[model samples]
Target: MLIRLKELRLERGYSMTQAARKIFSHPDTYNRYEKGIREIPLDCLITLAKLYDCSLDYLAGVSDQPRKYGR
Candidate 1:
C-alpha cells in the first residue's frame, strides 16, 4: 500500500510536499505514510483515492483495479 501510494504520487508528478499539500498534511507526516511508518486514516485514504482518481480498494491494496464504476 505504501509503495502503491508513492507510485501513484509519482505517476501524477507530485513531489512529497505537493502531495502533502493536496491532502492537507505535513510533508513529514505524508512521508511516514509512504514509508509505512504510520497508518493512514480512513478519511485521508479516501481523499487520496479521490485525488488520484482511483478506488479506495485499489489504494488500500485490496484490489488492483484503479477506477470505481461510474466515477
Candidate 2:
C-alpha cells in the first residue's frame, strides 16, 4: 500500500504537497498515508484512484492492473 501510493504519486510527477492539495489534505497527513503511519480513509482512497487513473484494486494491491475497468 505504501509503495503503491508513493509510486503513483511519483509516476505522476506530483510533489507530496501538490498531491495533498488536490485531495484537500494537509501535506503532513498525506505524507503519513504514504509512509503507512496512518490508515487511509475510503473517500481518500477513491479520490486517489481517480487522481492517479488507477483502479481501487490496484491501489489496494489486490490487482496488478492499473487501469480501471471500462476505461
Candidate 3:
C-alpha cells in the first residue's frame, strides 16, 4: 500500500504538496495517510482514486490484478 502510493506519486512526478493540492487535501494530512500514521477516509480514497486514475481496490491493497474504471 505504501509502496504503491509512493510509486504512483513518483511515476507522475508529483511532490506531496502538488498531489495534495490536486486532491484538495492538506499536505500534512496526505502525508499521514501515505505513512500509515492515520487511516485514510473513504472520501479521501475516492479523491485519490480519481486523481491517480486508479481503482479503490488497488489503493486499498485489496488486489494486484488491474481493472480499468468504467469498463
Per TM-score, the best of the predicted structures is 2
Per residue, candidate 2 scores C-alpha lDDT tens digits across 1-69 of 789999999999999999999999999999999999999999999999989999999999999999999
Write down the TM-score of every candidate: 0.94, 0.96, 0.88
* Winner by lDDT: 2
The list of candidate 3 runs beyond 4 A from truth reads: 69-71
RMSD of each: 1.0, 0.7, 1.5
Clashes of each: 0, 0, 0
lDDT (Cα, tens digit) per residue for candidate 3, span 1-71? 77788788988999999998998889998898889898888998888878888888898888784354666
CA lDDT scores, all candidates in order: 0.93, 0.95, 0.83
Candidate 1: where are CA atoms >4 Å away?
A: none
Q: What is the lDDT of candidate 2?
A: 0.95
Better model by TM-score, 1 or 3? 1
For candidate 1, the TM-score is 0.94
Q: Rank the candidates by TM-score, best first.
A: 2, 1, 3
